[model samples]
Target: MRLQKFMAKAGIASRRKSEKIILDGRVTINNTMIKELGFKVDPKKDIIKVDNKKIFLEKEKIYIILNKPVGYITSVSDQFNRKTVIDLVSKVDQRIYPVGRLDYDTSGLLLLTNDGDLTYKMTHPSHEVNKTYIAEVKGIPNNEELKQFKEGLKIEDYITSPADINIIKKDKGKSTVKITIHEGKNRQVRKMCEKINHPVIKLKRVSFGDIRLNDLREGDYRFLTDKEIRYIKDEINEK
Candidate 1:
């Protein structure tokens, strides 16, 4: 198998990340430092060391649904020694990586797993899986602003894809809006609201694809039920 593909199947990181690791000479194949992109290895025979630590295919796959709280980033590790979403599941025996991102301040549903194929499927823009977020913005958007959001807005150089949006609640000074979009751009919800002159005060993802946060609380997580996993596979049309 290809080196990056082997590393990805071993749950070390995504295929692209693994390629970078190989290119950086962090990976060694059979005691030789290999920076070759097309390097192939026999997983059952070749010894692979990343940063001098061995990595191999895991026997069991693990999946987790986490109710991520504010202040945690969605990465395997933080370079600044700050907390990452992976830290929240330290008790879990299996190594995993976040399927997508939720930003440092946004709080809500996040998925972690060792199934790299599923991770790639969910995170790929081509899949276009809708992610739903509820944001408390500065003020209620008038019909015009809402129309701009639904039709798509130009944030920076990139224009956003059309979003499914609606008002969930409204008060004198603040309004809660639910927006669903298929793209996973960085802080896309916050940027969208800001463009409409209703910057987000608070944001929380309520759902991803068919999986709902349900009653999960902040800083807590649970194993995905069989039914829920089945539903997610169906949504992504996973074989």
Candidate 2:
């Protein structure tokens, strides 16, 4: 396999991050520093190390979902020593990573796993996986603003893809919305709302594909059921 795949299989990092690790001059094979993306290795014959620490493939894979709370970044470690999603799953012994990212203030269904291939598939733009969020915005959007959401709006450099937006409730000063999107741009839901002049006050991802956040509470987590795993696999395999 390629060097990145080898590193991912060893549980060092995802293939993309492993490529960066290789290019950063942190990875070595057979006592020689290598920085080529095309480099391949024989797991049985090659000795691999990252920063001189030997790494071996994990025998067991773990899949978990967490109802992420506010303030924790979706990372393994923080340079500023702040909390991370990993801190929430300290009880889980295996090395796992967030499948995709949610903003620090964003809450709800976040999946963690050691299955790097599955992670790749989930994050790939080609997959076009859908994620749903419950958003509370500053004010109720009129039909024109709602049409802009369904039709897509300009964010930074580009316009967003058309989204599925449903009004769940509209009160005096705010409204609750059910918004579904395919692209996972940084702070996208909030940004989209802001573009429409509604600006999200609170956001929570309620679903990814068919997986719902359901009754999971803030800062709580649970392993995925076998059937749920099958559902994910089936969703990805769809033609």
* lDDT, candidate 2, at 132: 96
Residue-wise lDDT of candidate 2 within 47-123, one digit each (tens)? 98999988787889888989999899999889999999999999988888999899999999999998877787788
TM per model?
A: 0.96, 0.97
Error of model 1, residue 69, in angstroms: 0.3
Question: Each candidate's lDDT (Cα)?
Answer: 0.90, 0.89
Candidate 2 stretches greater than 4 Å from native: none
Best by TM-score: 2
Alpha-carbon RMSD, candidate 1? 1.4
CA lDDT, candidate 1, residue 31:
95
Clashing pairs in 1: none
- True lDDT of residue 135, candidate 1: 91
Which residue pairs collide in model 2, if any? Answer: none
